[model samples]
Target: MKSFEKELPENYDALKKKANYTSSWRDRLDAVTTLSAYQHEKVIDLLNNRMKNDTVFKVQTAAYKALVAFGENVEKPTPARFDVIKGPNKIFLRVKKSLPKDHTVEEFADKLKRMRLDVYDAFEGDKGDQFMTWLEERWAKL
Candidate 1:
């Protein structure tokens, strides 16, 4: 029978770094997706870690799928109750309060990027190409 083991990618260290829970959820998701192609034991370990512990539901789901693809027995994780950015409305309201009455949405977006990079990054990752439009709509509602 042929061995199905695969070699780790050259950028494995970088992928590991991105797999850390502290990294943005999107980064972790990207790492999981990239690492899933390999059949190495180390790769399986990394994907299992993400499956069991990543706070983002999407990341967890991706990790679970990858593990299943590798023929690992695993249950689908329940969606995490933790919000990517806690109290996002409150955070944005604070930003809105700090700005001048006449501030444009662009200025608000800039301030959001500067003041709360976590929120900015989370929204950017979650919204993808719709980020700007979502921000604009959110800004108007605020």
Candidate 2:
């Protein structure tokens, strides 16, 4: 997989075109992120619109990731709280409400999977516990 760090450019038009494709979610997100770095209002609008309507999970996830990645450039504040956590090789987000303590780790993992967050070692006891604990803390703050 191509990393977003190397593929994005400054052109907003090209980035918009990339966002319309089905196969290049990561690439498109990279491009958008790069464009967002310039803090252009138009670029942010285009990316937000696409992200809200995107059908594919990967694309939506990428969109959300890009939103967080370029958050500093956004002019308007979003109602949703976005939190990002980086693991060994992937980045995950706490986009909405965190899991409850009553819920099993498997259940929480399932929820994350449903949201298409790249969760790792979800079945391992310690890791799962840590993830749940993380959610619990986040939930408490909410």
Best by lDDT: 1
| lDDT for each residue of candidate 1 in 1-142, tens digit (9 for 90 to 100) | 2234499999999999998845387788989998888879999999899888765667888999888888889999986455556678898999989999999999999998889876787777656688899889978898
Off by over 4 Å in 2: 1-10, 68-142
Report, for all candidates in order, the number of backbone clashes.
0, 0
| Per-residue lDDT over 82-117 for candidate 2, one digit per residue giving the tens place of the 0 to 100 score | 222234223233523466556654565566556544
Q: Cα deviation in Å at residue 63, candidate 1?
A: 2.2
Number of clashes in model 1? 0
Q: If scored against the real structure, what TM-score would every candidate get?
A: 0.68, 0.35
Note the Cα lDDT for every prediction shown. 0.82, 0.48
Cα shift from native, residue 67, model 2 (Å): 3.1
Error of 2 at 52 (Å): 1.0
Candidate 1 Cα deviation (angstroms), residue 96? 2.1
